[model samples]
Target: MADSITVRGLSADAGQTPLLRDVSFEVRAGEVVTLFGPSGAGKTTIAMAVAGLTRPGVSLDGTVEAPARTGYLPQQAAGTLNPARRVGHALGELVGLRVPRMTRAQRRARVTEVLRAVAFEGDLGPVLRRYPAEFSGGQRTRLALAQVLATRPDALVLDEPTTGLDAGRKTELAGHLGALARNGVALLVVTHDPDVVAALDTRLLRVHNGVVTPSEAPQPRPTGATRPSVSCSGSPAAELRTVSVHFGSANVLREADLALFPGETVGLAGASGAGKSTVARCLAGLEQPSRGTVLAGGRPLPPLRRRTRAQLARVQYVWQEAAPSFDPRRPVEVQVAATATRLRGVCPGEALAEAREELAELGLTPAQAARYPPGLSGGQLQRAALARALLARPEVLLCDEVTTGLDTNLATHLLGHIDAYQRRTGAAVLLISHDPHVLTGRANRVLTVENGQMVG
Candidate 1:
C-alpha cells in the first residue's frame, strides 16, 4: 500500500504542558484510518499535527509526511464557515484557491460537483443561494465538507464528521466516505462515532490522555447508563405555543407547540434541516418567532436583551456550536464563571469556584478549563458550554446537540451530569439530539419535528 500520509515521532507541547508524545501513524492510499479517543485525549492534536498544524504557544516536534493536496474538515464548523458569505461563494472561492488556473466556468462546474457529492441531489442552485444559518446542523456540516471536497485532495482528514447527523445521515456519510476511500483517497478520520469506525475498518488507533496506540477492534455504541426516570405532574416550565419561525422567506417552524414540564427530560428528535433548534431558540428568547408566543412559567417571554436578568437566568440554552460561544481571547474558566456572576448575581470569587466545580463534574480538568477555546478540543468545549449553562441553575435548560462530539463513555458521563442536575433542582430539560438510544432511555417522551410541525 502506498503511504499517503505518515507521521513518525510526532510530539506536541504547549509551553511546558505536553499534549502529544511521540505519536506515529500512517494512512495508505485507498484506505481508511480512524482515530478514537475521548475529548481532550490528544486525538485532535494528533490529527492536526499530521496535517502540519499547531496553535499559538503550542510547539511541535514532528516528522509528518503527507501529500501536497490534503483536505482538512475541521471539527468546529464555526471557523470553517463565513456568516456573511453565501454557500456557493464560500465553496467557489475555495475551489479557486485550490485550482488557481481554473476558468470561471470550470470553478462553477467544480462547485456543482462537490455540492452534489456532499448532500445535494441534483440541482445545487437552490442550496447555493442560502447562507449557512439557513441550513440545519447536519446540512451546515455537509456544506463544510463540500468546501473541502472542492479542493479535490488526494488525502482527507475529517474531525467529528458525524457531529450533527441523524442515524440515517450517519449511515449515508459512512457509505460516502467508504466510497471515497475505495476510490484511492486516503482518509484519516478523527471521530467518536462507532458506526463510522465500523464502516471505515481499514485501521484503528486509540488515543488516550495524549498517547496513541493500535486499537484491536472497532468501538461500540454507548449503553447501560442507569437513566433517570421522569415523574413530573406540574404546569409547563417553558412553552412554545403556535410558534412559527421564518428566516426571510424560508419557513423554519410552523405552528410548533412545545412544552417542557418540570422534572422532565424531553428529547427533540428530527431529521437534518427540520427546525429543531428554532423551536429551542423560541423558548430561550434567542429567536423571535414570526408568530405565536414563547412562555416561561406560563408567562409570555420576549427576545433576549429585552428580557430582565431574572428572565435570562431562568432559561438557559447550551447551543450546538460550543467553540464560538466562548471568547477565544480569555480563559474559558473566566467566561464560564461570568455566566453565573452576571445571570445569577453571584460574587465573582464564588462564581469562579462553582465554575471550576461544575467543569470538573463534566469531565474537564481544572487545568483544561483554564485554557482558551482554541486550546480545547470540540467535545471538551461542549462540556464546558454545558457547565456554563448549568452554573446559571436555570429552571429550564435547553441543550442542542450537546453529546454529538462526545465519545460513548464521555457522552454517558455528561448525560449523567444532566440527570443529576435535573434530580437536584427538578428543572425542565429540553434535550435536542439525534441519538435514538439517548432518547429511548432518557427522555420521558420524544417529539418529532418534521415539515415545520411538532408531532408525537
Candidate 2:
C-alpha cells in the first residue's frame, strides 16, 4: 500500500490575508519529516490543512492528499480536549474511529494500549475517572497524543507536541515517534526545538513569510551568558516554606522550600507534572497549599479568593498554554489591556497603548492583536498571554513556560523584555521552563525538582 500525505501548491487564507502560500510537502510511509520555523509563520496552519481540519474562514487553494485514517494533534489543547470529559472516556471515543462498533471490553483494552504507548502508567481506572483539569500540562499533552494514536492512523501529524512537556517526557515522546516511523507510519512534525530534531532521523523543511522550502539545518540559537549575582537589600519578595499540595490522594508537591528576592529571576526546572506549576500557583494565591506557608513580602499570603485587589495586583501568573487560559469571545488586545486597566489603574487608552507596544516587541502586529484567541496561531496566542501578564507590572511574576511555543528570536526578545522590566522595577520573577537555555543569564538562580521534591 502506498500510504502517504502530500501537499502541492497549498495556500491558506484568513480574512482575505494569506497565511500560507505556495507551500508544498510530502510524508511517505516509514519516513519522518519536520517543519521548522519561527512562530506565527503558518507552520501549524499547514499541519491543520493536511489533516483536513482547517477552520471555517480558512480557504485552501491546493490539494492535501493523505491516507484515510489521519491522526492530528493540534497545538492548542483548549479546543481539542473536552474539559468536562474524563481522559479515558475521550480516548475511548476516539477509539471508535479505528474500530467501529467495538464491544465495551474491546474498547477498554484498546484505550489502555494507547495510553501505555504514551508512557501513561498505573491503574487505568483512576486515569479514566479523572478529568483533563486534574492532570498537569504534560499529562494532558500525553493524553491528547493517546487520543490521536487510538485511531491507528497511517499518517500522524503533530503540532508543538513538546510545548509543555519536561525534558524527560520529551525524550520519551521522541523515542515513541521514532519507533512509530520505523513501523511504517508517516510522521509529520511542526516544531522549532532543535532537541526534537536531534531525536529523529528526519528531513528538515523551513517555513517563513508564508512560504515553505527545504532547509540545510536547524538555525543556531544565540548563547546566553551567566547572570551576575544581584544584591538583596530587603525582605524576600515571595517565599514558599516547606509547602505541599495534594490533588485527591496524590501528592503533587512535597515540602518544597523556595525564596525569591527583589529584582532577581529564579528559574525552576523539573520534569512535567513534577510540581513546578503547582508551586507557581501557590505563590500567586491561585492554588492553596495542603500544608506549610506561602508568604509575600514576609507576610503570610491569603488564598486567591480571599486576597484583596492590591494583593492580587502584587502578583501575576502567565499560564503555560495561552489558548486554554484565554477568553475566546474577545479580541486578544482587549484582554491584554484589561490587566493594566484593572490592576494598575491605567486608563483604557493607555492600557491599550502599552499592550500594543508589548505585542509589537513579541512579533505580533496590530492586525493579529485584533483577532480572538482561536483565530491566532499558537505562538501568537502565547505572546498575547505574556503581554497580558506583563501589563500588570506585578511585584512578583510567576511565568510558567511563557515561551513554550515561541521561536528563538521571539523567545530571546521576550526574555530581554522581562529582564529589563525586572531591572527597572526591582520585581521578583519565578520563571518555570523545560529549556535550561532560557535560564542562562536570565535567572539569578536555578533549582531542579523531581517527584514533587526540590533536589537543589
Candidate 3:
C-alpha cells in the first residue's frame, strides 16, 4: 500500500525564526508514528504541516503528501467545536457532509457509533445534547477526535490527544488508536505523555529545539521532586458555598463547595467531565452560580464582568490550555504585562519588567516571550498564562492544569516558581490536574469532585 502520509525535508520558518528544521518522515498504512519531545520542541508545527493547516505568517519549505481524506485533532481541542451549537449538530454536519447519501437517522446512528469508539464512560444522550463548553478538557479532546473520525480519514494527526485524560483513559485511548492502526489507518501522534509514547509500536522521532531526529531526548523529571516548599496561612482566601451551575437541563455542579487557604496549594481531582472546570469557572467569576454564592475573604464575589478591578486583581485564573487566553496579534510578553498594567494601574515599563522577571523564572527567555501566541509552544504559553496571573499578584490563583502541556523539567521549574511566589506573597493556589503525581507533594490539601459534588 502507498504511504498514507509523507514529509520530505519539511522545514518551517516564521520570518527570521526557524520553527522546524529539515524534518523528513513517513507513515505507512496501519502504522503508528509518534513525534515525542519537550515543550516548545516543534512537534505541533510538524503536525500542523502534515494536516495541511499551517498557521499564517509561517512558511513551509518542503513537500508533504497526505490523503485527500485526512483528519486532524488540533492541540487546542476546544477550538474544534462550535461553541454555540450542541455537539450533535457539529457531528451531524460532518457525518452529512462525509456521507451525503445517508438518511438523517443513519447519520445519527453514525454519530453515536463514533462517540462510542472513543469509549466515553456514560450514555451518549447527554453528551450529544450538551454544548461544547459543557465538557471537560479530556472530553473535548474526545469530541475533537470524534469529529475527525466521523469522516473516516485515511490518515489522522493528533496533537496532545491524551491530555486532560486520566491514566486509565490515556491507556484506553492509546489502545483505541492501536486498534485503529490495526484496521489500516495511519496515525501521527504528537504528545509529551510517556505513557502514550510507550503504548504504541511507534516510529518514535524525538523533536528538540527545532530539529527532529531519531534519537531520544532526556527523560522528564518525575513529580514529587523538590520545589521551593509550600506553606499555608490561617484564613480562607477564597471559598465556594453551595454552588450550582446549570447548562440547559444539565446540572453540572450541584451544591459544590471548596475552600482555598492563603499560601496553600489545593488540588482538585476527578475523572474527566466530573465538573472540575465548573468549579474553577465559578471561583474565577467566569461562571455565575445558578443558586449559590462565590466568596473571597468571606464576602460574596460577583461575576467576572461585575467584579471590581480590585476583585479582578485579587483572584486570577490560568487556563488548562492557555492559547485561547492570549491575543494572536500581539506579542506574548506585551499581553503578559497587560494584566499587571490594566489590573493594578502599574506603569507600562514596570509591568513589562515584572512580566519579564516572572517569565524568566518560569524558564521563558525574553526572545521567546516576545513572539506572538502562535509563535510560542503550548507549554510556553502555559507558563506565560501563569506569569500573567501571578503578575496580578492575586491572593487566590486558580491553575487549571497549568503544566499539562509541559515536559518534566520545565514543569518542575514552573512548580518551583509557584512555590516561591506563594511563600513570598501568601497566594493560595487551586490546582486542577489529572496526573496524581502532579498533586502528590505539591498540593497541601486535596479535594475530589464526584457526581458534581465536592468531597474532601
Candidate 4:
C-alpha cells in the first residue's frame, strides 16, 4: 500500500524562528505514530503542517504528504467546537458532504452511530440540542472526537487529544483509535499520557530544540519525592465539605470532601466525568456548589463576587490550556504582572522582577518573558502560567491538569518547580491530574474519584 503519510527532511518555521527542523518520518497504512517533545518542541506545529493548516510566513520545506482525506483534532477541543452548535449539529456539519443526499432520519442515524462509536453515553436528546457551553469539558472533548470520526477520514491527526479526558474516557478513546488503525486508518497522535503511548505499537519520534529524531524507547517517568507528609499544626489551608455540583439534573459531582493543609500536596485522580475538575473549580471559586460549603483558613468562603481581594488571592488556579489563560494581544510580562498587581499589591516594576524570577525558576530565560503567548512554546506557556500563579504566593494552589499536554521532561520539570515552590512557601496544593504517574510517589495523599464520588 502507498504510504499514508510521509515527510522527508521536513523543516518549518514561524517568521525568523524555526519551529521544526530536519524532521523526517513516515506513517504506513494501519500504523500508529507517536510524537513526543516538550511544550515548544513543535509537535503541534508538525501536526498542523501535516494537516495543511500552517499559515504564510510559517514556512515549510521538504516533502510532506497525506492521503486525500484527513481529520485533525487540535489541543483545544472547546475552541475547536462552535459554541452555538449542538453536538449533533457539529457532527452533521462534518459529515454533511457525504450525507448531503440523505434524509433527516438517515443523518440522525449516522450521528447516533458515530456518537456510539466514540462511547458517549450522555442524554443525546438534550445534549444534541444544547450548545457546547452546556456540556462539561470532558463531554465537549468526546463530542469533538466523535465529530472527527464521523468524517471517515483515511488519516487522523490528534494533538493532545486526551488532555482533558478522564481515565475511563481516555481508555475508551484509545480503544477506538486502535480499532481505527486496525481498519487501516493512519493514526498520528501528539500526547503526553504514558497510557496512550503504551497502548499502540508506535513509531516514536522525539522533537527538541526545533529538531526531530526517531526514538526507540519511550521517555522515562519521573521519580517523585518519597518524603513523609509535612506538619500542619494550625488550621488547614483549604477544606471542602460535601461539595456537590449538578448540571441540569445530571449529577456531575457528588458530595466530595477534601482537605489541604499547609505544606501538603494532594493529588486527585479519576476516570473522565468523575468530577475531579468540578471539585477543583469549586475550590477555586470558579464554580459554585449546588450544595455544601468550602472554607479557607477556617473561614467560610464568601460569595465568589463578594470575596475580598485578599480572600480571593489565597487560592489560585493554573488551567490546563495556558494559551487561553493569557491575553494573546499583550506581552507575556504584562500578562504575568497582572496577576501580581491584582493579588500581590506589587507595582509594575516589582511585579516584573518577581515574574522574571519565578520564570527563571521554571527554566525560562528573561528574554522569553518579553514575548507574547503566540510566540511561546507549549512548555513556556505552561511555565509562565505557573509563574503567574506563584507570583501571588497564594496559600493554596489548585492545579487542574496543568501539565496534561507537556512532554515527559517538561512535565517532570514543571512538577519539580511546583514541589519546590510549595516547600518554600509552605502552601497547600491540590493537584488534579488523570495520569497516575503524576501522583504515584509525589502526593502526601491520593483521592480517587469515580462516577462523581470520592472513593479512598
Candidate 5:
C-alpha cells in the first residue's frame, strides 16, 4: 500500500530561530505514527504545516504531502470550534461533498453515529442545538473529533486529542483511531500520553530542542516525589456541599460534595461530561450552584460578586487553554503584572518584577515575558497562565486539565513545580485530569465522576 503521508528534509524556523530541522517521516496507510517531544519541540508546528496553517514568518523548506484528504485537529479545541455554531452545524461543515449527501435527519444520524464511536452518550439532541460554550471541555473535544471524522478523510491528524478526556473516553478515542487505521486511514497522533503510544501500532518519533529523531526505544514513564498526606485539622481551604448546576433544563452537574483541606492535592477524574469541571467552577465562584453552598475558610462565599476582594483572592483558576485567558494585544509581562497589581496592591514595577520571577520559576526566562501569547508554544502558554495565577499567591488553586498538551518531560517538570509550591505554601490544589498516571502518586486524594454525579 502507498504511504498516506510523506515528508523529506522538513525544516521550519521562526525568523532566524529554528523550530523543526531536517525532520523527515512517512505514515503508511493502515498505520499510525506517534510524535513525542518536550515543549517547543515543534510537534504542533509539524501538524500545522501538514494542515497548511504555517505562515510566512515560519520559513519552511520541506515536502509533506498526503494522498488522501487530511483532517487536522488543533491542540486547543476550544479555540478551534466556532463558538456561535452548534455542535451539529460544526460537524455538518466538515462532511465532504463526495460523501453521500443526506437530509437533516440523516445528517443528525451521522453525527450521533460518530459521537457514539467516541463514547459520548449525553443528550446530543440538545447539545447539537447549543453553542460551543454549552459543552464542557471534554465534551467540546469529543465534538471536535466527531467533526473531523465526519469528513471520512483518508488521513486523520490529531494534535493532543486526549488532553481533556477522562480515562474511559481516552480509551474509546484510541479504539476509534485504531479502527480508522485498520480501515486504511493513516493516523498521525501528536500526544504526551504513554498509554496512547503503547496502544497504537506506531513509529515513535521524538522531537527535542528543535531536532526530530526516530526513537529506538519507547519513552520512559514519569516519576516524582513521594505523595504527601493532608492533615484533618483546621478549616478546609474550600468546601462544596450538595452543589448542582442546571443549564437550560439539563442537569449538567448533580448534587456533588467535596472538601479541600489546607496542603491537600485532590485529583478529579472522570470521562467527558462527568461534572469535574462544573465542580471546579462552582468552587471558584465562576458558576453559581443551583442548590447547596460553597464555603471558603469556614465562611460562606458571598455570591461570586458579593464575596470580598480577599475572599475572591483566595481561590484562583487556571484553564487548560491559556490562549483565550490572555489578551493577544498585551505583552505577557503586562498581563501578569496587571493581575498582581490589582490583587496584591503592588506597584507596576514591583508587580512586573514579581511576574518575571514567577515565570523563571515556572521554567520560562525573563525575556519570554516581553513576547505576546501568539508567539509562545503551548507549554509556554500554559506555564505563563500558571505564573499569572501564582502572582496572586492564592491560597487555593483550581487547575482544570492544565497539563493536557505538554510532553512527558515538560509535564513532569510543571507538575513538580505545582507540588513543590503546594508543599511550601500549604495551598490547597484541586487538580482535574484524565491521566490515571498523573493522579497515581501525586494526588493526596482521588475523586471520580460519572454521568454528572460523583461516584465516590
Candidate 6:
C-alpha cells in the first residue's frame, strides 16, 4: 500500500521562533504512528501541520505529502461538538457533508452506523437527542471519534486522544484504533500517554527542542509507591455536608459528603459523568449546591457570589479543561499573574515575575507564557493553570484531571511539586481522576462515586 502521509525534513516556526525542526516520518496504510514528547515540545504543531491546519504565525518548511481524505481530532474534545445541537443532529450534518446527495433518513442511518462502529452501546434515541455537554467525558470522546469517522477519511490525526479516559475506556479506545488500522485507516496519534503508547504496536518518534527522531516507546510509572507524609491535625481545611447539585433536570450530585483535612490528599474516583467533577466544582464555588452546607477553616462558607476575596483565595480550582480556564484574548502571563494581584495584593510587576518563575518550574518558558491560549499547547496550558493556582497559596486545592495531557516524566515531576507544596504548607488537596493508577499511592483515602452518590 502507498504511504498515507509523508514528511521529509519538515520544520515549523512560529514567526522567528522555531517549534519543530528536521522532522521526517511516514505512515503507510494500516499503520499507527505516534509523536511522543514533553509539554511545549511541538507535538501538536506537527500534528496540526500533518492535518493541513495553519497557526497564526507558524510557517511550515520542507515537504509534507498528505492524503486528500483526512480527519482530525483536536485535543479539546468538548470543542469538537456543537453545544446547542443535539448529538444525532450534529452527527447527521457531518454525514451529509460526506454523502451530500443522501436523504435525511439516509443521513440518520449513516450516523447510527458510525456511532455503532465507535462502540457506542447506549440507547440511541435518548442519547441522540441530548446536547454535547449532556454527554459524559468518555461518551464525548467517543462521539468525537464518531464525528471524525463519519467523514470516511483514509487517515486520522488524533491529538491526546486518550486523555481523561479510565483504564477500561482507554483499553477500549486503543482496541478500536488498532481495528481501524487493521481496516487500512492510517492513524497519526500525538500524545504523551504511556498507556496509549504501550497499547499500540507502532513507530514511535520523540519530539524535543524543535526536532523529531526515532525513539523507544515510553513506559508507565510504577504505582503504589511511598506517599508524602502529611500531619492531619486540627480542624479539617474544608468540608461538604450532604451536598446536592442539580443542572436543569439532571441530579448531578445527591447528598454527597466529603472532608479534606489539612495536609491530607483525598482522591475522588468515578466513571465519566458520575459527579466527580460536580463535587470539585462545588468545592471550588464554581457550581452551587442546591442543598447542604460547605465549611472552610471550620466555618460555614459564604455563598459563592457573596464570598470575600480572602475566602475565594483560600480555595483554588485547577480546571480539567485547561484552555478554557484562561482568557483567549489576553496573554497567559497577564492572566496567571492576575491571580496573585487579586489574592495577595501584589503589584503587576512583582506578580509577573512570580508567575514567570512558577511557569518555568513547570517546564514552560517565559516566551511560551507570553502567548495567548490559542498559541499554547494543551500541556503548556495545564501547567500555566497550575501555576496560577499555586501562586495564590491556597489552603485547599482542587485538581480535576490536570495531568491527563502530560507525559509520564513531566507528570511525575509535577506531582512531586504538588506533594512538596502540600507538605510545606499543610494544604489540603482533593484530586479527581479517572485513572486508578493516578490515585494509587497519592491519595490518603479514596472515595468512589456512582450515579451522583458517594458509594464508597
lDDT of each: 0.85, 0.86, 0.86, 0.80, 0.81, 0.85
Candidate 4, 233-346: lDDT as tens digits: 788899889988888777878898888999999888887666787887887887888999989989888666877889878998887767778887887877888788998789
Better of 2 and 3 by TM-score: 3
Root-mean-square deviation of Cα positions for candidate 5 versus the true structure, in angstroms: 2.6
TM-score attained by model 4: 0.91
What candidate 4 gets wrong by more than 4 Å, as runs, is 1-3, 55-57, 121-130, 134-136, 166-168, 219-227, 230-233
Give the alpha carbon lDDT tens digit for every residue of 1-456 in model 6: 354899889888887788887888899989999998888798998888888886676888888777788899888776788888998888988898877999878888899888887667677887788888766666677789889999888999999887677777777788888988999989999888878889887899898987888999776667785255456667889989999987667788999999899889988898776888888878888777999988898888876688888998899988777876778889998899999999899999999999999888888877888988888988889889999999999999999887868877787777778888888998999989987667878888788889899976
Query: Which segments of model 6 are wrong by more than 4 Å?
Result: 1-3, 101-106, 225-234
- Residue 36 CA displacement from its true place in model 1, Å: 0.7
lDDT at position 116, candidate 2: 82
Question: Which of the two, 5 or 6, has more TM-score?
Answer: 6
In model 4, residue pairs whose N, Cα or C atoms come closer than 3 Å (at least 3 residues apart or on different chains), thus clashing, are 39-378, 39-379, 166-272
Pairs that collide in candidate 3 are none
Which residue pairs clash in candidate 5?
Answer: none
TM-score against truth, every candidate = 0.95, 0.94, 0.95, 0.91, 0.92, 0.93
- Tens digits of per-residue lDDT, candidate 1, 151-230, equal 78899999987788887777778788888888999999998877777766558899997889998665465543424656
| Residues 1-456, model 3: lDDT tens digits | 454899999898878888888899889999998998889888999999898878767899999999888789988887878899999999999988877999889998999988877767567888889888888888988988999999888889999998888777888888889999999999999988776777767888999878988855335445564234354445589998888998888888999878788877888899888898889899999998998889999899999999999999999988787888899999998999999999999999999999999888888988888888987778888999999999888999998888878877787788788888888998889988888778877887788888788888
**Model 6 root mean square deviation, Cα atoms:** 2.3
Q: Mind giving the per-residue lDDT tens digits that candidate 5 earns over 197-311?
A: 7766678888787677887545657645426666869789999988888888879888898889999998888877678888888888889999998999888886767776687
Give the higher-lDDT candidate: 4 or 6: 6
Q: What does the lDDT come to for candidate 3? A: 0.86
Best first by TM-score, ranked: 3, 1, 2, 6, 5, 4
**Which regions of candidate 3 fall more than 4 Å away from where they truly are?**
1-3, 215-233
For candidate 5, what is the lDDT? 0.81
